[model samples]
Target chain A: MSFLKYRLRMDKNVHLIMKILTVFSIVTILAILLGLLYKAYPILKTHSLTNLLLSKDWFPQKELFGLFPFISSTFQVTGLAMFIAVPFCLLASIYLSEYASKSITRLVLPLIDILAGIPSVIFGIWGIILIVPFIRDYVAPFFGKVSSGYSILTGGIVLAVMLIPVMVNILLEVFNTVSRGYKEASLALGATKWQCIKHVLLIKSAPGIISAIALSLSRAFGETLAVLMVVGNVTKSPKSILDPAQPLPALIANNYGEMMSVDLYDSALLLASLVLFIIVLFFNIIARVILRRLEKNNH
Target chain B: MKFKAKFIEERIFKILMITSTSIILLSLGAILGSILYKGLPSLSWEMISQTPKGGFYLGKSGGILNAILGSFYIAFGATAIALLVSLPVALYINIYRKKFSKYSNLVRLCLDVLWGVPSIVYGALGFSVMLYIGLKTSLLAGIIIVGILIIPVMIRAMDEVIKTIPKGLVEASLALGSTKTETAFKIVVKQALPGIITAILLSFGRAIGDAASVMYTTGFTDNIPKSLLSQAATLPLAIMNLVSSPIVEVQNKAYASALILTFIILFLSIISRLLSIKYTKNKSH
Candidate 1:
């Protein structure tokens, strides 16, 4: 009877501990939300939402607070990066999924994974060492006069390279997840393998591919180190890829330490962050919606 | 005639795909080659052993000894803290699915937000929090920032692994008169050990390679830290420091450090991938 009573006591204790842990998990989530809210506090308090959204100048130094330039530069970089990455990633994914021998896939996939693991700073370093000089000497000369060695082109190219592995991995996964039966059926109908991939596999996995692209674009938008290192930190609107420009992340990172006015600095940083948060949140929502749609269609 | 046309088209498609994939492979190769060509000659045993001093123009005056050690210390420390805070919560959410599962979606959303929050913002927040708490530019600040950064990744990975543990096994343990704790620890987590290890390795790779978040929070210093409170530079930060300097020699050293950092991350990622594959194979068996 005593042993039974002890067992009951232990079970109760275990239940209590589990309850406490669940609460802790919730608390962890709450803490993150609160942290983001705290970061967003300055923007909430000072600026009207519309003005904050629609303003153009991003000069925190002169108290000219607008995110238009940052947003434009971010879009430009992301657009260029995606333009460069999407085709390459799609073609690479098709090859890996459809054509590569098993042994080659085994070797190549891990190489891409290693590329994924290469730090952004290293990419930044490489861009600065190799790319900046090439651009300054060759690309810039063709485009006309360029002063700073670092340009928007340099940053965009580096960002594109940084994003390749992510795009390839996600797209490869999506391609792999496509049912083999679809391919076989298409092939049996006298469709060539490439035709099957183009019509059946690609179309079927379109939503996943879109999400992968969205995710990569969002990543490029928020990418800081490589962009900061390569972009010449110029605040003006860029005329060409050869012109220096400041994206949102690079702006916040470069100016955070140098801002003498705490209110202006914090507000600017918060605004930039808020914009980035919105971009990422929007992409996440889109991805989830697409995924749900895919699920529904499958069912 | 139709078959010949199809064969020709297929050949063209295959050639295009191969060329595109090879472009990616070539880009990676070029990057590695460029880093090596610039960085390799500067790498020396002495350079690896000595502490950084003065500027790059002053020449081979210092090594990256302190930064490498600091990198390992901060990464391991952050990983340990993150695992401690994330594992229990993952287990709690998993074991009590009915009560906690509703919150799991919210937890995942929060993690996604955290992951998407730019690293520089984390640095700023850490700087503010650390300054508020009177721990400015210390290793603790670095660890805290990194810990936050790792949490989202760790929890997400851990939750997936925990969910994958077969419900039947857990039920069996419970039916055998084991309590919930025993079922979780002995049956669920034990079976998921390899997955958990993979999660750790992933976080470790992330923490080691991370620079922007730690740059401001950690406040780079060349001195080897005597305690957690001491300011120290990490390998990534050291690389950043070198690249920014106007000196060519320092830039070369930066390249070397970048190479080393890349090598380490590459090694860890390969190991993690292998482990994950092995775990999957084991499950199939």
Candidate 2:
């Protein structure tokens, strides 16, 4: 009887502990949102939304805080990187799901995992020594006369390389989940293997693929050190892909050391990060909803 | 001669597919080939064991020993913290609640969103929170933020492993009159031990390799962190600092640091793979 009582008491303690930890996860999420909001309070209170988001002036030393350039630069780089990787990811995903043999799938998939696991700093290192030089010497000259290696094109290419594996992994999963019967029916109707994949699988899984792209876009939007290393960290809006531009993340990373030196600089920068956090979070949630629908369709 | 359109289309697609697949392989090959080509020559015994002296960024003296040790310290501490939070939350979702219940799904959904978030965003949040609390960039802040960053990964991975445990085994344990708490901690978790190890290894790999999140939360210092409040350097940060410098020797050292970071992630990958294989073996019993 005593042993039974002791066991019950122990179970009670464990359950309480487990519940607290689970709740703590939710707490942390709220804490981060509130913290960023609190830090951005000054700008959100004083500046008009359009002025803060769309103005071109970003001179911190003079106290004018405009986020138009950084926000546009973020989208521009993400758009370029995604544009470059999407077709390759689409084709490779189809190949992985439809045509690759088990041995090849087994081999290629692990390699993808390795590529994904390699850190961003390594990507930054590669960007500085290899991609930057290649861009400056070979690619940039094609665009016109450009002196430095750092620009939007350099940032976009590096981001594309970093994000392709992520896109392929998610898209491949979506493609594989496509109903086998759809393909079989297509082939039975005299469609060729490629036709079956193209008409049946690709059209059916479009939403999932879009979500995968959204997920990758979220990453590209927030990528920092690699972009900072190659993007020249310029403050002005980029006139062309060859022009160096600063994204929100790169701006925050480069200026945090000196932001305190300027009035309202810290508040504005934190506000920029707040905007970034909320945008990325919003995109991620949309991707999840689409992904959930895809999973539901499969089941 | 009229060619069958379907046949021609298939042939063209076959070519396109091969080209696209090769693109992936080619990109991987280029990154690895260049990193190794530049990094291998500069690697040395002293580089791994000594701290930076004056003008280390100029490539004149000392080693990355402090950064290496600091990286190990932060990652190990962060993993330990993440494990404490992740295991219980994962177990609660799997064992304490009805499987795939609405609450469990909501938590899983939240975790999925967290998983897709970029590391730099975490850094931004960490930086803000540190300022709010009047804390400087220190090892403690780095660990706290990183521990938070990896919680979703650890929980989701562990949940996946636990979810794969056969329902029959769980039912049998309940039929034998074991307590839910006992069954969870002793039986369900025991069944998922190999997978738990894999989860830990992967999260450790993530914590150690991430640079952006620590860029602001853990400011770099040449010395090892003496206390949690002390500033510490990390390998990825060291690589970033070195490669950005104008000195040629420092650039070479950056590659060596990358090689070491690569080796650690590779070792973690290999170990996790072996552990997952063991997980499959255990499942058969």
lDDT tens per residue, model 2, A1-299: 89988888888898999989887776766676787788888877888878999999988777779999999999888888888888888888788888889898888988888888888887877887787888889887886767488888888888998998889999988987888888899999988898888799989998998899888888888888888888888889989887889999998888877777777788898888888888888888888889988887787
- In model 2, what is the error at residue A60, expressed in angstroms? 1.3
Best by DockQ: 2
Q: How do the residues A137-172 of candidate 1 rate in per-residue lDDT, one tens digit apiece? A: 988777687646698888888998899998898788
lDDT of 1 by residue, B82-152 (tens): 89777766776787564235466556655655566667767766676676678868888898889888877
Give the DockQ of candidate 2.
0.70
Name the TM-score of candidate 2. 0.97
True contacts kept of 2: 0.62
Give the C-alpha miss distance for residue A280 in model 1, angstroms: 1.3
Provide the overall lDDT of each model, using Cα atoms, as 2-decimal numbers. 0.79, 0.86
TM-score of each: 0.91, 0.97
lDDT of each residue in B104-220, candidate 2, tens digit only: 888888887777666777887778778878999999999988898999999998998898777888889889877778989899888889899999998999999988889889999
lDDT measured at residue A191 in model 1 versus the true structure, 0 to 100: 92
